[model samples]
Target: MIVSNVSFGCTKANSAWCVSSKDGHLEAAANRSLSPTGHLIVAVCLGFIGTLGFSNNLLVLALFCRFKVLRSPINLLLVNISVSDLLVCVVGTPFSFAASTQGRWLIGKTGCVWYGFINSCLGTVSLISLAVLSYERYCTMMGTTEADATNYKKIAMGILLSWGYSLLWTLPPLFGWSSYGPEGPGTTCSVNWYAKDANNISYIVCLFIFCLVIPFLVICYCYGKLLYAVKQVSGVNTGMGRTREQRVLLMVVTMVICFLLCWLPYGIVALLATFGKPGLITPEASIIPSLLAKTSTVVNPIIYIFMNKQFYRCFQTFVRCPNPSFTSSFRSTSKTTKPGQKSRKVETNNISIAVASMGRPSTFIQNRTNSNGEQGLSVKGSKPVVSLVAHYNG
Candidate 1:
């Protein structure tokens, strides 16, 4: 309408109307707000993505609640992650989607602050939860069995600390350590990256360091340790163990890649906007990374949980309702034979790994009969072999 007025109607319209139309045109261009079509596009994408994340994460929560056997400690951290993602879908995405369709923020200033705060707070919780999850996996693989029986206690503490650490950084912005406002095309809210004042800069720096940097570092270190442990275990000269080692390495790489893919670009753009000269990062460029960050809510559970064979089995069972028929049993299944020792296998589950009072023994032989009473054992002369099975049936 403004463009048409300037292009044709301005010549014949009243002088006042002509001037007002021109001002509106320039203002819209200067604000760099998305056009109506662009906003509708964002709304559609958010609607689909947000609904998927909401449903999947809600299902994950329900699975934990309905099934007592899946309520293991490590699984609790996963549940916490799903909870944070669910909150993001519920609280953060809906508001953004609504504002996008409206072509501007619908809520007032205080609402923007709360919007930014809740999203950032929950995002930080997810990040911290992933880090905590990685560190816990590292400790478990490193066989830190001293406190194995108290796994639940540690996980409960981890859940508390994740939220507490997230709040430690996010809450400061609400109380003037920094500030929250509309960000990324004026349809979403987050930290005021445009502000270059000392207060805002300091807070952004601290947030970058604590919320993003620290969690990433923790993840890398923990997964790196896991790789090293796998390398050591792979020395027993079995193709199965070597293959498992490679799979774990791939999982670690994928995990790290996902972490970077989701968060790193967002952090980079935030920094550039915060410290760069005016217009160094445009609204168009910044919104892509913002969308990627939002996408983590959907990507996380699919990558971290559903992809796991055991979890998928449980998920299938859970959804099947009346006659859930997946017979799931996880075996730690570490097979090893020392120099001259007979071949041995250690079969345990996540539960055994969690509650085993002693460290894992390298080579132990235990004859076992299957549920059908069929006996099987590795013969004495079998070549030295080792295998480590990592699954989640706790």
Candidate 2:
């Protein structure tokens, strides 16, 4: 049914506005409504999902800020991810939700640009951070604990570069390489795929490849190598089951899988929209991909913090009223590696403790001490070894 506004014609199909004449004011009437039933349902659902994401990311920020131990090099990358996702929750979700309900772009052109830029930046940040996290973990699996701990400078550089990279792709829209305007359901803003021309189409293709495809490939390569190393380590020490290490690895693997599942469909849909024939997907149908993409922000906290036993314990301790034991528990301790023990160094100190809590071998430099009090950097049994052997530099 057509909805009558004082100055314009509105349709339920796309919530599009068309005036009877060009001189008619572009401003939609403040009291005008469109597709009330459909918009209301979409609005409620987006609001709920956005709230869950915002709250989860908020908790992550609070936990990282509250705990001193979490300030380690690897966790700083996590903090970066949380900050990016939190900004998206604060700036992008609400605007998109409201616009979805209103059935059109209510925030005007300037708001649309800001919304698209910020959301695009945060999305890129989230993607790059995940890849960096995976690479860092992979390095930890292959490097000494001391080497991993000392690479704080490198980690910081990586975080900064990620933000820069995000801007590199997102800012071009403002420069005429492409443009940002209303997208799916006309309630959200993204790269204007509708502007299908040589320049805009090229930008879209490059953005997708650089932002999504490359990062995905890097993450897969890192995880694959890390898992292979884990398998080799397991086979070498059949007498001692690395139950704890295996469990931690399992959780880490699950997190990467979740990240892919949450985002891959959205990326696929976006690519299809950009490269495929016109009218390939209805605006209403686009909501599914948008919702799936937002879900990544919510699931991140569960993977990065809540599922981690150490972070949970630290959070519990932080929440308690000040006490002598609580203060003591918060204090950092330095442990020297003893001669002749097997240790697996994790990329981050938090990962070390997380694995320790899981009753597995930790990311410590494990050296074997022989009967004559001589220490040898070697695997205990005759099982085949892998690149992890090169990490024993002590």
Candidate 3:
């Protein structure tokens, strides 16, 4: 049996997405729709998500650009993530918002394909960039030597690899390994998970394994080790060090959980459409995961602002005063050493307070004097990260 909502053609086999020929018959290419109330709700929600994501991420980028202190190599990876999310706000969400407001797929087939491809590309960039950022953080946490924080070349290479890797996975869909079509209430589009043919199923499987699984594993592995490593810090046995380590552990966990909570539902639902029988996911239910995934753009910057000492300080300073030189004054002193030098000690200052917040070891403890009258923190090996940490400690 079939039900009609005006021109919509709904069948029991795939009741969630009703076919509608009124919008130039393009929705017949596999788009679907929602009731008027549902469309209004989605439109309002998209407006909020899009506006907040765009504005917050824009502020983050502005803070980065305004402060030379925030230009460290590690922060570059963070900036890359913000860039990807910001692009999604500008390019991907608007079309869906328009479609939802108008109660149909407004841009037709070509627009649907573009929307799916661009969203996939940008989303993958954010995912892989997070993994890379975690790996870099691990390297920074493990030692102040190789993979040091000031290595611009390495950071640039990681940025390139993220975008290149995303293109590698997303472009194939354009060439017909799989395809793009509407999903969930027909106001948006993505890789056509509903198709049961070998081509579509195989593409979805490969995409699931390579694009989603591997990057998320990399993130979990890096951050998991970070949690363990934080506990093992030389200072963690001490009261202050232990407190700082616990804080770091909480931040690492928060980041991992946010990524999992945001994308996992969408991933699960997409797989259900790929493998389960049609209508296994209702259009209303399907939109929940989509909304959850989009919320990631909003969540990430919030985490950075509230949880990261460096980012928080920078953000605070940026808010209070927008001058670059004023921001640089907090971070301009060079704290590095020439290669082959033994551990040197420096007196703790306002600049050194960030070391404790950054989860540096007991050797790098801050805000108090060490055994020697002159020494506040002891660093064994000399690398560019010493300078970077000096800035980060700001």
Candidate 4:
């Protein structure tokens, strides 16, 4: 008979707690002493929240890319950030949640290796992307117009370096330089951070420095410079419309705040897990903290789309067609021909053509004469030019 395994280790070895011999070789049931209900609840909540953040960011990225007007360098980087976060949420979080729940890995050796590799790689990439964005904003606010050809090339190189850095941390396990295996209470997979091996400790330390500390320092420095630049430019109107520099400053501040909030815990935990003595903190506590660290991926998109007005407007335009009333009103206001000059149907068709070529010189209007027999001069003695420029660049 199959019996619960918990009783087998007792001094009086209860038979009811022991499985029958015919059931084959039995490993002891993993300890559930630390599997508190509250921990599970938190894990599930984080997983759901992370998933929502991931989905929102993905939607924003997709909308931005689909519209030509939204394709700026800043938005392009934001898309990269969102895609990284999406992978973390869509690919990483579920494994994390499962590890939290079962407290032991249900998936075996190969799954553990893959999950750990992806989790580390995505986390590294997200951190680097955040740093890149922070630096970009800092440069833009400082009026540093140096981001021309050389800067773009550098940015591209930086992206490649970030991936290479991530792979550097993630690939060693495949070669056995470091180990990734199931943690106690087998629901999650991670680097064997607490292993007694000196190589593991060295690898963990290197990962923390390259992946976390250095990036954090770069982001902090860039954002600090950005804040100083914003203050310096406080009085100067950049003439880019009513949206003040303060608004962009606020966005940057908000992004930095969220990044710190979401990531600080994970960084602390990793530091402690790597250098501190084992048994100081249980694996259960680390599980939630680890999940929290990865939540930044999903959170980045929400911050950009919801907090920035320009991004929101571009997002709306990209996702939905222009309002019918607005389109019609625009056509009427820009129409070139007199309303009574032609049949209603012909007038309508002409209006469409006029709207289509609103700013360009066209053959249809080349021979048209003004009341003074000049080439359609306005009262100011200039051509009655029609200008229609749509400004949707984010």
Question: What's the number of clashes in each of the models?
Answer: 1, 8, 1, 9
What ranges in model 2 sit over 4 Å off?
Answer: 1-35, 144-151, 238-242, 245-249, 319-394
- Best TM-score among the predictions, by candidate number: 3
Model 1 lDDT tens row, 1-394: 0111111123332111121331222223225556678888888988988998998898888877865545556778889999999999998999989888877666755677798899999999999999998877766655553323224788899999999999999988778887676676767878777666688789888999988999999999988887876665454325544775887788889889999999999999999987876667766787778888988888899878886544665687776643422242212211221222221234433211111111112323234578898644322222111223233345
Candidate ranking (TM-score, best to worst) = 3, 1, 2, 4
Off by over 4 Å in 3: 1-32, 144-149, 234-237, 321-394
Q: Poorest 10 consecutive residues of model 3 by lDDT?
A: 353-362
Over 1-394, each residue of candidate 4 has an lDDT whose tens digit, in order, gives 0112222333132111222333221334344223558447746776786678677877877777665434444556667777777887787677657655654344545776687778778877878877876666555434343223113455566577667777887889778776665433335556765454577668777877877778888888876775554443332223321233456566667877787777777767666755666444464666566656666665777776556544565565556787987545434432433222211111221221111111111113223466786542112111111111111222
Instruction: Report the alpha-carbon TM-score of model 3 versus the true structure.
Output: 0.78
Window of ten residues with lowest summed lDDT in model 4:
354-363
Per-residue lDDT of candidate 2, residues 1-394 (tens digit): 0111222135443433443432222334333343567677778877987898888888888887876555566678878888888888898999878877766666766787788788888999999998987777666555533333334687888899899999998999898897766565566777766444688679878987999889988888887776666555454344332643475468758876887787787777777776666556555556677777888888887887777655666677767766876555445221222222243443321222112111111233345778999753343322211124322222
Look at candidate 4 and tell me the lDDT of residue 124. Answer: 79
RMSD of each: 9.8, 8.0, 7.5, 13.6
User: TM-scores of all models?
Assistant: 0.77, 0.75, 0.78, 0.68
Instruction: Report lDDT (CA) for all predictions.
Output: 0.68, 0.64, 0.68, 0.54
Span of 10 residues, lowest total lDDT, candidate 1? 1-10
Q: How big is the positional error of residue 224 in model 1, measured in Å on the Cα after superposition?
A: 0.9
lDDT of candidate model 1 versus the reference? 0.68
Quote the positional error of residue 192 for candidate 2 in Å: 1.1
